[model samples]
Target: MEQLKQALTSAPVLILPDPERNYVIEADASDQAVGAVLMQDQGNGLQPIAYLSKKLHGAELNYPIHDKEALAIIIAFKTWRCYLEGRKTTVYTDHCSLKYLKTQPSLSRWQVRWIDFLETHFHYDIVYKPGHKNKADALSRPAHVAAIQIEGMNPLLKGLFTHGYTIDPEIPLAEKRHLLQWDNDIAYRKGSMKIWVPNYPPLRQLLLEEYHDVLYAGHFGSNKTLTGIAKHYFWPHLAKDVQKFVTSCDTCQRMKSSKQKKAGLLQPLPVPEQPWQVVSLDFITGLPPTTSGHDAILVVIDKFSKMGHFIPTHTTAHTEETAQLFVR
Candidate 1:
């Protein structure tokens, strides 16, 4: 054993349980200094499952207090679900903050939903270990092995599910053209002109089944329609529809106010021939008391040279005081 250890000390050694299961992970600076191990119970004996020497990005970072934590919880729950995909298992982490899984008092609405998801899915145990001992499992494997990017599911589907498809061919050609035109206009405006949909059949089906109500809602404005389409569809596609719908809305035209003409058409004022020869004056008010107990500023601008003086004053400054300030 001593000879083998010396021979293998310089090589990357991987420890595994019985030969069937393989786990891959890497450690960051934080976890490298504090090694971790994993132990699995094999009925007759305790097996050394994995060893990690580094930190995983998500677990060790100081994530934000609200939405980020909720995201972390969802990530953790998903990881746990994958770990126990087809069987019951025990999970452990050193993050004691997660101990309040069931009854977290200050969790936001989203976090509560995540907790409910954890409760509904797999049955498992979450044990918190001290940071020093957490190295056994925490350091044994990299943190990202737990990350599974499950895309295309409805955001509300808080559990694992498969993607399903449907088709619709009855949408009118005129409506399709209108949608295409709007898509193109928006794509051009947003500098995403490269986007294309080879066949509109699947999109037609998706819109008809999932987005028909929102699209047909009363005189869909750009912001409202964009928000509606984006909820169920990807942004680029929705941007096109939003651009088209907004451009075609009759009610928007009738109610929209005409934009004011540009002000730059007027000639600029002549430059001051002499500094302090002519002056524009105005009073600034409603300020908090300054160190000098003043709450206003009398602004005097020289009309010729465009220079100005700001004199601070109390609210009670009389006409005589104002005259004195201007002279000063």
Candidate 2:
């Protein structure tokens, strides 16, 4: 149990699956339970997308090793059907008998049913792997239980339910009506977190700090940070707040560079119809003083005629003087 906890928390072993990448399923079965690990190859190596496990009950406990392993694959496929259904998947098991499972001349009723289900529902390649090489082996055993912390209700929500008003006055009124509801003294949403985040400055700032500056948070970009926070909390304009917080974050400003592409293409200016009507003026300064006591020249160009005018002037001429000179 301790080892499982350590393994789970040591680093990020699981990641969101990408549809463009191929998937691998590693399944194993113990006498008591069956477990499977879903993984994807992202060029770096195999990264886990999810892990599933369930205890054996009823007739499942009496199944032999071959049936148990095959059952693990079936259960795993059904559990992750959304991701596995249309993709090319490879199923790995320690049982070598499964390598040619379809070729077996004789089959039990359960085996026949399982084979039919596998052939009909999924497109997969079954491969035999040694137990020691299977990463999901520990999950199949009884010792695979790991300590996990569930984010309980947000602190601000408790205050609202108990006192009928939250401490934070800044939290919008519409959010309470639109986003939240209570049942059995516990908050529930259509598909949101049990935790509620009040728009109070202190609590909101604290939440941002925990997710942005904390060691585990890794100071990721605003979108990822908002996604992570949304999994466990909710507030009105939460995404707007996340963007504001990330934009103002000092560490992010200093360490990270912008990856966004520049907006809009350059458009050329329209050509002029006549000379002097669309003239451009520029000062050429820092020249050697001339006999006329002028150290700069104003060069004006006519757009249509390409005509040029050179006007001598003092380098330090004020705006009004320059304007008068242009008019003259």
**Candidate 1 residue lDDT tens string, 1-328:** 7977454343234233433343221111222122434444545444444443433365433333223323433454464345434444454544444555676568656667877776777555655543233334333323432221123334532121111111123223423554422331111111121122223444433442232233235444466445434322343355666576576656667877656775667686666678777689899999999987999999999887667789999788999999999998
Query: Can you write out model 2's per-residue Cα lDDT over 162-248, one digit (the tens) per residue?
Result: 343255553335455576555555443433323455545666676777777777668877876775565345666899999999989
Best by lDDT: 2
Cα error, candidate 2, residue 293 (Å) = 99
Whole-model lDDT, model 1:
0.46
TM-score of each prediction: 0.30, 0.42
Q: What is the C-alpha RMSD of each candidate to the true structure, in Å?
A: 23.7, 17.8
